[model samples]
Target: MDNVQKSMNLMGLAQRSGNLISGEAIVLNAVRSRQAKIVILASDASENTKKQFLNKCEHYSIPVRVDFDRNEISNAIGKIRTVAAITDGGFARSLQKLQ
Candidate 1:
């Protein structure tokens, strides 16, 4: 599989391993509290969402990735979500390496 596919698969693993947080509110909280190692924003997300997350991530000095669409992210995590946070540093590092 390609790196994108591998990344998606790793997201699923992260979720299963309880190292990921999904949904807007939870992710926002995680980011603000510095609990999120990295945030992934769906490419198809709304402008407001992109702006908000980009601003928050920028202010907090957290890494963000917008490589996947909503469908890809939702499919990987088995949930309909536009945003997600990898809370574990190890998982975040692995995903970054894949990117």
Candidate 2:
């Protein structure tokens, strides 16, 4: 399978394992708590939203990925989310490897 498919499957696994958090408020909270190992923002997200997340992630010293668009991310985790966070180190490492 392609890298994109692999990444999406991994996201599903993460969600099933309850290690992925999505949505703005939840993800921000996770970042603040240092529970989020990686933050992913949809590449097609609005400029303002993108800026806000980028700044917040930067301030928290959290890693961020903006490789996928809204649809791709939403479909991957079976949620309509423009932002998501991987809380587990193993999942985060696996996802990063797909980049």
lDDT tens digits by residue: candidate 2, 2-73: 988898899889998999999999998998999999998999999998999899889999999998899999
Count of steric clashes across candidates, in order:
0, 0
Model 2 stretches astray by more than 4 angstroms: none
**52-76 per-residue lDDT for model 1 (tens digits):** 9999999999999999999999999
List the global CA lDDT of all models: 0.97, 0.93
Runs off by more than 4 Å, candidate 1: none
Task: Kindly provide the TM-score of model 2 when superposed on the true structure, using C-alpha atoms.
Answer: 0.95
